[model samples]
Structures are given as structure tokens and as C-alpha cells.
Target: MSNDLAAQHRPALFHRAWTVAVIACLTIVAAAAFAAMPGVLVDPLHTEYGWSRASIGAAASVNMTVYGLIAPFAAALMDRFGLRRIAMTALVTIVVGAGLTTVMTDVWQLTLYWGLLIGAGTGSLSMTFAATVANRWFVRRRGLVIGALTGSSAFGQLVFLPALAWIVDHQGWRPALVTLALTAGTMIVLIALLLRDHPADLGQRPYGATAFVERPKADQGAARRTLRVLYGSVRDRRFWLLAGTFAVCGATTNGIMWTHFVPAAQDAGMAMTAAASLVSMIGVFALVGTVLSGWLTDRFDPRPLLVGYYAGRALLLAALPALLGPDSGAVIVSWVVLFGLLDVATVPPTILLCRRVFGADGAIVFGWVNAVHQVGAGAMAVFGGFTRDMTGGYGPVWLLAAALCAVAAVAVYGLTPTAARTGDPAKA
Candidate 1:
């Protein structure tokens, strides 16, 4: 009887793991759909409306800011209201925002639709969502699962950028926006049909927990709990260091580079398609880098991993200005390949650091830190454009980003090294 029951349970376990993979894939597609928009839209909006780069950048700034700011609350809300409901709502919201964006003529409308609405929607589905699902569903190979999901987020850029750029270049920007709306609307149906908030909802325990171990109680008053996590985190020096370093991470990568790289490449006489392809290449390398970073995080101290990443980023950014022109060839490609490897690779180590320092509230604390990261990114998105207008080139901005990375490299070392070992699987 016992052997028969064990045989029967194996397939059920496989089903649960399969469900987690599907949810992770859905999250990846949603992330990619929204993330690919800003870069593809930048040049078209500039040419079509004669909008200043600064004005267009401001809308991106708004999008990035709202995306970051809402993350913690969104995480809390998911915990309270359930993941499937929140995820479905987020998809619908994105559909509305992207669909409406196709018709906007004014800058503020662009900001309202793309910046605020789409930003809010995507915020709910960010890395926090992946972490939540990984934590709740998987016990074994959790690190690998989280890394895979994070890579999917980076892969979203790779999957969407070329097609999006092609659409904007040949068809029109409106069609690109419409395509995004439809993609998101399709995801809404998938989420409603398949997503489950927890494994327990399907009569399974988390993958690794002992069957006899009681499930942990859900936090009552998730909103208040989220606020307390942020407040308590503020009092910790390690939290500040993590947030500060990650803020620079956001500034250099998502803020300045993702928003402006294509335009800057175009300024150097590259085709829009070529520039977008280069950005997508970065996505490819970022996927590899982030997943490897996750493996490193599980085995080594994350502090050193982060230090190495920031140093690599600083070197690459410093080289960017010289590598921009059409004649640069292999040198430019090498620079981009290296830059992509370091792009969002900062995330896994950053997540590790948050878990180390904040313990039980690590995920929520990471949300607040991520908000600061976006704050930095938003500031740089607007400032990079303004700097371009002032200097007539992106050279100065690249140098500034390199300088920030250097500063971050030094700043990360100041974090409490004691925190580095916390929750390390190797240590376990």
C-alpha cells in the first residue's frame, strides 16, 4: 500500500513543478512585452512629433519611477489578494495602457498612458513576482528556478527588441503599440486559466518542505507589514548600502542605456535596426550573466560578485564613447557584448544581499531597494536626455555613468560582510 501511494504521488509532484514553470514563463512574456517599448518608441516619437529628447525621456522617467515605486505595495497586495487575481488585473491594465497609447497625441497623454499606467501594471509583475513564486512553490533547486526566471526577464528584451524596432522602422509606432496590447490581452486569458496563488491551493506542499512541517501563517495587514519592512530597513546601514549601490545599478543600465542607447547609436550613423539589435545582444548576454550570477550567489559571497560586476560595468561604460562610430566594428561589438553581460546581472547578487541583511522580510525590503533603484534610473533617464541636448552628444553621459559605477564599486565594499553569508546554500 505504501509503495503504491509513493508511485502515485510522483506524477502529482511533477505536475506542480510543471505548473510553476508555466507561471514563470507567463511572467517572463509579460515583462518582456512592456520592457521593450521605451527603446523602440524613443526615436519614432522624436522624429514624428519633433518632441525634444528631454520631453520623451521625461515620460520614460515617469514610467520607470512608477514601475519601481509600486513594486513593494504590489508584492504586498499579491500576498493579500492572491497572485492570479493581481496578475490578471495587471495584464488587463497593461492592455488598456498600451492600447490607449496608440492614440495619444500630446506628451502628457504619453506620460499618462505609457508612463503611469503601463508602469504601474508592469510593476506588479517585476522580479518580485518571480521571487514570490519561486519561494512559495519550489524548495529544491530554488536558486536555479529564480535564475531562470530572471534570465527570462532579460530575454524579454532580446525577444521583443528586433521585431519592435522593425515594426517601428517599417510599419509605424502605432502598430507596435497595438501589437503589445494584443500580446498582453492574450496573457490575461492564460493567467486566469492556469495560474494558482500557491501549491497548497492544489493540495500540495512547497516542493522542499517536509510534509509534517506546518505551513507558515500569512502576514495579516500586508500593507502595514510592508511599511514596517521599509521603515525598519531604513535604520540598517547595510540596507542603505544595498539600496545605494543598486540605485547606481539602475542609473547606468536601465536609466541611461536602455532608454538612450538606440538614439545614441543612430547619432553615430547606425541604422535604428542595428542599434536595436545591439541592445538585444545585450539582453542575450544579460541572460547568461544573471543566471551565472545566481549560481555564484549560492556558492560565494555576493559582495565580491557585485564588486566584480560593477568594476566590469565601469570599464565598459568608459569605453562606450570611443566605440560608438560605424567604423569601430569588432571593438564596438566586444564592448556591447561585455556591457550586456553586466547589464542587469547586478540583480541576483542584490537579491542575495537583501536576503542576507533583512532575513524574513528580505523580499519586501528588496522591493523598497528596487524602488530606490528605479528612482535613480528615472533621474538619469531625464538627465541623460538633458545632458545630450546640452552637449550635443552622449559622450559626457557615458563618462558620468562610468564614474557612478566606479563610485558604486567602492560603496559596495562598505556593506557589512557579515551579512554576506546569511542564507547561503553552501553554508547550509
Candidate 2:
């Protein structure tokens, strides 16, 4: 064939929007598997090693914090290297870190493997990946896409938690870790095959940006502007509001629940598999909530949405302490539905805030916000574990999580309208 004819006949990458959606879903599944993998091992580590709950929880705490700390830098790295390369690298790192966990014999090793390595890997798979999708793929339905991605993370937790619990019971924690590593490695190849940095890289425009004429290539404004965006957003009140709410979000969801839910369920006399299944149910609700949150973000004010979610979460946290025990199944299931529905629902709005506040710098700005979320989660995970150690239960932590959610609700509600300034009024 002639060269022109060959070029015309070549298959277009990202030819359909559904293809992008599928790739996004696959990334979320890979991400969710690793994220939930640690949770499954938490109880097993304690059972086998006779490790104190605090020690085990501390490892997870470190993981949550490191995961958060790495988010901003990870976003920057993705921006520099492109999402495809960074994601592929993260997938490999996660596999290695997870695979090594099977042989851990001490607390410090657990911390290093699960906390530093896996946490960093998960962070790379997090907001950086989310931003890549929102920034590059669909302009018209950015909110919906982000919602689905965030929902997938929650779905990972839901589907994998109980299943992993069964794996631990039948095959031991080693197999569970091995399964996670293999699954994550497979995802790396899929990502490399499917993902591109941006729509333009594939000779297409973002769904919404299509109406505008293309601008000529510019100099290194893209590089220089990252700093400007970072600096400007750091000074904004709305940024702090989003960050503060997210921090509280970390404190409540990951800081308290992901680190302790299985043990907490045990305290209430539920079996490990049963407890994990309950947590998985929460993931189901989160999937619905996050997707709805995304759809809502496109149609309404994100501030009100944030307010509602946080407030609802506060109520659930407060009720969590009173709801404990063997008879708590109904209560637990309700909490899962309510909490899950509101769980990742906060993310899309927060992303929206990032875009509105920082304009071209939304990706990196959101990265910083995600970092705050992680740090908040880390701080709480550490303290909550210590609290449980002192108190012999997670009751106090549950109450505290509720209070934090209340604070977050108020903080979100207090955000100035000017803070959410979408460039186009119609879009907002």
C-alpha cells in the first residue's frame, strides 16, 4: 500500500469513548486490589505473628500516610512523564511490594513492604491517574468519568475485601499477596497497551474542547505554569476547604475504618469473612454514591453536595459505636449503604474544586489536595491505632471520626462561591 493509504487504514487509538472508559475501569480494578490487599492481611498478621493490633494498624497507617504524601509528587511525575509510563511503573512497584509481603517476619518489614512500597504504588495509581483521565480524556463528561473512577476504587474494596478474607482462610495470606501481585502485574501490561497521555496525542480533541480551534504549539509554558498553579491554589481559601474536608474524609474512612474495621468487627463477635463481607457491602454503596456524586457534580453546586455527604457521614460515625456486636449486622449493613453512598462521592466535587480554583493547574493542585487527604488519613490511622491500643476498642475512634466529619461538613458548607469559579457559568 502507499504510505498515505497505510496511514489512513491504521487503527485509531482511543477510537471510541467506551474504550477509554474500559481502560479507566481496569486501572481502578488493579488499584482497588492492592488497596484492599493490605486490609485482608491485617487480621492474619496479628493472628500468626501475635503482633499487637496497634503495631499492625500502624503499618497500615504508615501505608495510608505514605500513599497520601506521595500523591502530589506522583501527580507531578505523571505530568512530566505522561500517565501511561507512570501508571505502568506504579503497577510494577505494587506487584513487587505486594509479592514481598508473603515472607515478612517482623513488624518493621511489614511497615516497609505494605507502608512505603505499596503505599507509594497506590498513590501513583490514585489522584494522578484520576487527573490524567479528567485532564485528558472527556471534556463534556469529566465529572461522570471521574465519579466512575473513584467509584471503582470503592468497588475494589467492596468486592475484594471479603473474597480476600476467604483466600486468607483457605490458602493463607501468602497466596492472597501473590494473587494481588500477579493481578497488578497483568494490569500494567493492559495499561501500557491501552492508555495514552491525552486525546491530542491520538490526533483527537477532548469531548468538549472539540468546538474550539487548536492553538499553535507553545513553548515550555506547560512546565512553568505548574508552579504558578501550585502557588496560587495554596493561597486560596477554597483550596483549604477542599483539603480540610478531604483530610477529615481520610480520618473517617481510611484512617479509622480501613485500618480497623475487620478487627472492630471481631470485637463485636462477627467472623473475619463476615466482617470483610460487610465492608465490601460498603464498597457497593460507595460505587453508587461516587457515580451519583459525579453526575451531581455536573449538574449542581459541589459545595452543597460536600456538605450533605460530610454531614451524613458524621451521623453514621456517631452511630457506629452504639451499633457494635453480633446483632450489629443490620446496623453495619445500613452504615455500609449510607457511608458507601457518601464515601468517594467527595472526590469528584473536590476535583471540581481543584479545576475551578486553579484552571490550567488543576491536575497538580488536585495533587496537593490529595496529599493533604493522605496526610490526614495517616495522622488518624496512627492515632486511632494508638487510641485503640489504650482503650482496647475502636469506640473512641469512631466517635472522633464522627466529630471530624461534622467539622468537615461545616468547612465544606463555608466555602465561598467564588472559590468554585468554573470558567464558564453554564458549566457550573
Candidate 3:
């Protein structure tokens, strides 16, 4: 990552790496569009199919789980095959999965299409894809790229949600889905045209690299490699602390906010479009926070930064109930700004920790950690739904997340890379 002659010879104004970042951003946005769809579709599916909130939420739970769980494997697969191939495959799967949702009658079909297929497709991209891209393409500004990729999640919401909500409002959920499928289909063409597996393919060294990085030949069986890393890393307390805090991150953000906020706002008498707009605004601000977090991660210890992020999130979640209710205004708008900044800000730091502790296996280890992230999201998704069904409000869910995030802040407060201390990543 040190300055080299390869860095000096870089394009003055335009870098191919930026092109790759743009493509990666678009890909994440497309996948996130599908991920965000569940929130809008939840009530409609419940109304039309007479499915309980818990049942529909269960499907969402499965989607989040698949999304997280597939990440490490996706990382390994991308290593074995290539980013372009895996990316196109994910987009096609997303299109097919979204298309299938149009005709789904049974909740099981929803689970099959939305939960498994779309989840897997989008999951293959998120954090793992970002980590891979940053690792392969750039040496300088690497954290910035990861931050951009993380922030792109918000961009996905900002770009897709309001329009999707409008479509659902004027047309129907099915048409909205058709629109989503087409959007994802377009990204397939984009990725096919732009994505590359590595910088070496383009006859360029990684940006800022003094020497050419030899692309590591991946061992056969991506799943085997993924699991082997997991098995080794799981014993480390730092991994658990990172995983534990990230779990809360998932629950507070994706689980409750992305999956439940719109519906909860609707239940509080806010218009769906209005609620969706606020969510989009959150994404818009998230871009700022996540990007700044990346910049900060590069300059400081990620551990303290994480504690602060979680602590801030805890305070925010605790205040969510009051902010969502009738007569909500300036307070809620202010809330969105803070929430957006906090959303996905945890990503850069968490990935940094994985890199510091796990070293060579950092990308895959991050993937496994992200799997827990989704599982946590999935758990809260279902629990949020069940809480809604039982208590007729999302207050309990908000309080629980607040409490958990508080715990996470405490859990990660003094965490350091024990593996780094021992000079052995496998030593717990």
C-alpha cells in the first residue's frame, strides 16, 4: 500500500478504479432496491394474502439470513471465479427472484423467492463485495472505497425507495415488483460491461501499489474455504465481540429501520410516501456518515469509533417511539439526519478490525461476520413483526434494540485485536 512508481503513473484526472467503484455502487443500489422492497410490500402482502405480520416477517427474516449467510461464500466464489461473473449471476438471480414475486400466492412462495433468491443475490454483494473490490483495486484510499460502498446502501434507498413507494401507491405491489426486476436487469448489463475481477486484468497495478500484487490463486471449493476461516476465527474473542456488536448494528439498522420503519410510520398515521421519503433521507445522510467513518477509520482506532457509533445508536433507538408518533416534525427530521449518519457507519470500522485481527483471511472473515449481521437483522425482523402483531405497536421493538445496542457499546468498549497481540490469528 506504500507509494510506488505505479501510483505515480496513474491517470491524472480519471482512474479505472473510480469506474469500478461507480459500477460497484450501481450494483449495490440495484440489490438494495430489492432489499428495501420488503418494507413496502409487507402490509400489502398481509392484506391481500391474509398472512399475519409474523409470517410475512418470517419471510423477511429468511431473506436477511440468506443475504448475510451467503456473503462469505460469495466472497470465496468471487475469488474462485471472478467479480464480473459472480456479479452478473447475482443480478440475474435478483431479476428472476423479483419477477417470481409477482405471481406468488402462498407465503412459502414469498419465502422461496424473496427470502432465498433475492436475499442470496443481494447478500452476495454488500460488505463482502465492497471488501473484495477495495482490497483488489486500490491501496491508497482503500477505507474510503469501503466507506463509499457501505454508504451506497443508503444511496440505494435514496435512489429507489421513494419511486418504488410511489409505484406501489399508484399501481400495485406486483407492478412495483416488475419495476424492481427490470431495474436489476439493467444492472446486469452494466456489470457485464464494466466489472473486472482484478486490476491485473486491465494491465494496471492496484492504485498506490509500488509493486504488482500477485492475485492469489484461490483453493478449490469456496464453501470449504469460507467455513475453514470461520472455524478458525470463531474461537477468538475479538471475533465474537466484533460479531456481537455488529449483530446489534444489524438489528438496529436493517432489521428495525429498513424492514419495519415504513410500516411503523404508516401505523402511526403517516403517509406511506412520506415515510418512505424519510427513509430515503436517512440513506442520503448515511452516505455522509459512512464515508466520514471510512476516513476516520483510516486515521484512528476503530474500536473507540465503534463504541461511540453504537452508543449514539442506542440513544437514538431509545427515542424512536416518540419521534414516530402523531405530530412528529422537526424532531423526526433531525432524527433522520442523525440516524442516516449512523446507519452503516459501523461497517468500515468492523472491516478494519477484521483486517487487523484476521490478516490474510480478513475478507472472508468479514463475510462470516456479516452473516451474523444479517442473522441479527433477520431475528429482529421477525421479532419486530411479532411485537407489532401482539402489542399493536413497534415501541417494544425499538426499546429492545436500544437496550441491545447499549449492551453492544459496552461489550466492544475496550476490545482489541488479541490475535494481533499473539501474532497468531487462530489463537483465541
Candidate 4:
């Protein structure tokens, strides 16, 4: 196969990679929206069901844990079975979970539906999904595609948060849950109708490839292979570096900030709508930052980029305590803008690092790294609530996250650099 020969079969409207990227982005958007819903529901659940914050946080902790832990396996499954099949199944699972969440009367049901089922489902569509799509589809613009997809996750929060908050505030939490279910249901149909497993399925090479690159053969026993990777990864210092840094990334952003920020703001007497809008603002800045980080990953080394991002985040988090008062409008706005920029920007560079260090198995390796990230996140999600319950405020948690960010900044600097296989022309 020649480049020109592959070009001859290209679709008129867009590259199939772009089409797949769009579907992947949409899928992630739906999943991200569901992930953000718990934050908005925390107070409402307390109000309606008389659930304690710690109990709600515990359910979120379970969700976060399952969400992260399932990712590596999901990546392996996607490789062994098929992307479209896994994606479609994930969407259906999300629909079932979210639908059941609306009718749940007990906290354990919340844990089962939202924590186990929805968490696992959303895990399938996480950054690993973005990395898999980018790795399998495009050789030339993988970083940009990653950024776009990552940004789409942030954009999902931007689009859904305010409105969902409004619905939760005005109508009720049930309506908000129903909205997520419907969104997942719609994405399931879209994935089933439009998504293909791979470009090769349509008789085309990966975009930017001259010939079909032979992928590594999947291990005959995926479970054993995954366990082997986990065992091997534990001994590989580079994996620890990646996993440790990402654990902080998860702890600060998804675990502490996303899960607790709304309630933290509420504790300072901010309205739900106002707090949700602030989070939406963070989403807006995150979209820009993640996309820009993606572009930078293509052109520069990711190690320094991660160091800078972490350092900046530390500074922002360190300043958060003084910024969280009724009269701190200017400080709050600045925090939202700065924090959003740093929010998910860690993803692109982290993914780049995975590709550089892990080579052919980068996506799945990242899935394991992400699992650690979520574990850290889950720990903090529970801890943050418990801290608040014990201390009557989130001030200490913010400071703790800031300290973790500082550690991540120093830790990322220790990572040895490797050549990124960005857009390998042979890899289809």
C-alpha cells in the first residue's frame, strides 16, 4: 500500500479518523457529564434524602475507585474485542446505571448504580478511550486529537453543569438523573450506527500512514497479560513516576476540586448556581488549556510542560483559602480562570509520556496509570468530605491538594525523557 493509493480511497467530507474522533469526543462528553453530576447532586441528595455528606462522598468514592480501576482492563478489552462494541456496551451500561439512579431509595443503591455501574461505564470512555482512538486512528495529529478529545470532556462539564444545576435546583435531582440517562441512551444509538472499530475495517490505512502498520498482537489471555503488565509495571521505575504523578493529578482535580468545590463554595454561602457557573468557567479554561497542551506536546518535550503545569496548580491551590470568601470576587474569578487552565491540561502531557515510555502498549499502560490516578482521587473524595465533617470546612483539604501538587511538580522533574512516537507513519 502506498500513500497515494490510500489517499484515493479517502472520504470526501473528512478523514475517517476525524469522524471517529468526533464520535469518541461525543462519547466522552456524555461520560464526563455523568461524572460531573455527582458534584451537583451532593447537596441535593443531602437535602432530599437526609444523607450525610460523608455518605454521599463515600458513594462518590466508590464511583471514583471503580471508574479508575476498570480502565486498564477496559483498554485491554477494547484491544481484544473491538472499540465500537465496548463503547456501545458502555453507553448502554451508563443508561441503565443513570436510569436506576433516579429511582434509588437507599444509599447502597446509589453506590451500586452510580458507583459501580456508572463508574465502570464512564471509565470506558475516559482519557484512555481518547488515547486509544488517537493511537489507532491518526499518525500525524495524535496530540491535537487527544487535546480536542480531552477538551471535549471539559466542554461536557461546561455545557451540562449550569443547566443541570438549574434543573437540580429548580425541578429536582430526579430530572437531572433522567437527563443523564437520556443523553447516554442517545450516544448508544449513535455509536452503534456510526462507529467502526478500526480504519482497516473499511479497507483504509490509519490516517497519515502510507501502509498498514502491524499492531502488536493481543495476548491470547488478556486477563493474564494485564496482570503481567501490572506486575511488570510495579518494577518499572518509569511506570511509578507516571503513576505517582498522575495520582496527584487525580487527587487534586477530579477527587478534591470537582467533587468538593461546589459544597466548599456553598459552605462560604455561595449559591448553587453560582458555584456551578464557577465550575463551568473552569471547564471553559480547561478546554483551552488542554487543547494548547496537546499542541505543545506535539512540538516540545512533555516533562517540562508537566512540571510547569503542576507548579502553577500548586500556586493556585495555595492561594485558594484566602480567595474563598463572600467579598473575594476578583480573587474568585482569577482562581477560576487560572485553575481551569491547569485542570485537565495534565492529560495530554501524561498521555505523551506514556507513549514515549511504554511504546506499543502506551494506551493500556496509561489506563493503569489512570487507575492509580482515580484511586488517589477516590481516596481524596472520601477524605475531603471526612475532613470537612471533622473540621467544619474545606480549607485544610485545599492546602493538602496544593502540597500534593508541589510534590508532583518535583516528581515529574525526575522523569527521564524518551522519544515520543507521535504520528508514526507505519502505525495503522
Q: Return the top candidate by TM-score.
A: 3
Structural RMSD, model 4: 3.0
Ranking by TM-score: 3, 4, 1, 2
Query: TM-score of every model?
Result: 0.92, 0.90, 0.95, 0.94
- Per-residue lDDT of 1-428 in model 1, one digit per residue for the tens? 99986765443436575576666666666656677778778778888898988998999999889988888888788788888888888888888898889889899999999999999988888877777776677656566666767777777756578888999888999998888788778788777778888877777777755462344566679889899888888988888998999999989977988888888998899888888888888888887888777777777788888899999999989988888976778888888788878887788777766766766576788888889998999999999899888888888889989999999999988987554233544321
Q: Every model's Cα RMSD, please?
A: 3.2, 5.2, 2.9, 3.0
Misplaced by over 4 Å in model 2 are 1-15, 212-229, 419-428
Model 2: per-residue Cα lDDT over 1-428, one tens digit each: 69887665454454555476678677767776766755667667778999977788778878887887677667666666777888888888888888778778889998999889999888877865776676666776789888988888878756788878998999998988787788888888888888877666766666555343242343345445556666777777778877888999887877777767877888889888888888888888888999899999999988899989999989988888777678775767877788888888899988887777666557677877877887887787777768877988788888888888988888787675553343533242
Positional deviation of residue 414's Cα in model 1 after best superposition, in angstroms: 1.8
Over 1-428, each residue of candidate 4 has an lDDT whose tens digit, in order, gives 78887666553446778888889999999888987887898888888899988989999989988989888888888888888989988888888998889899999999999999999999988888899899888877789889989888877866588899999989998998888888888998889888887888887678776677665465567677677678866777888999999999999988988899988988998888888889889988998999999999899888899999999999999988878766668779988999998898999989888888777668888999999999999999999989988999999899999999999999997788755344432222
Candidate 3 Cα outliers beyond 4 Å, as residue runs: 1-13, 417-428
Candidate 3 structure quality by residue, lDDT tens digits, 207-297 = 7666777777866888888898999989888888888889889999889899999999999999999999899999899999999999998
Q: Find the 10 residues in a row with the least total lDDT in model 3.
A: 419-428
Model 2: lDDT of residue 115: 89
Q: After TM-score superposition, what is the CA distance of residue 168 in candidate 4 from its true location, in Å?
A: 0.6
Lowest lDDT sum, 10 consecutive residues, model 1, at: 419-428
Residue pairs with backbone atoms closer than 3 Å in model 2 (clashes): 158-280, 286-340
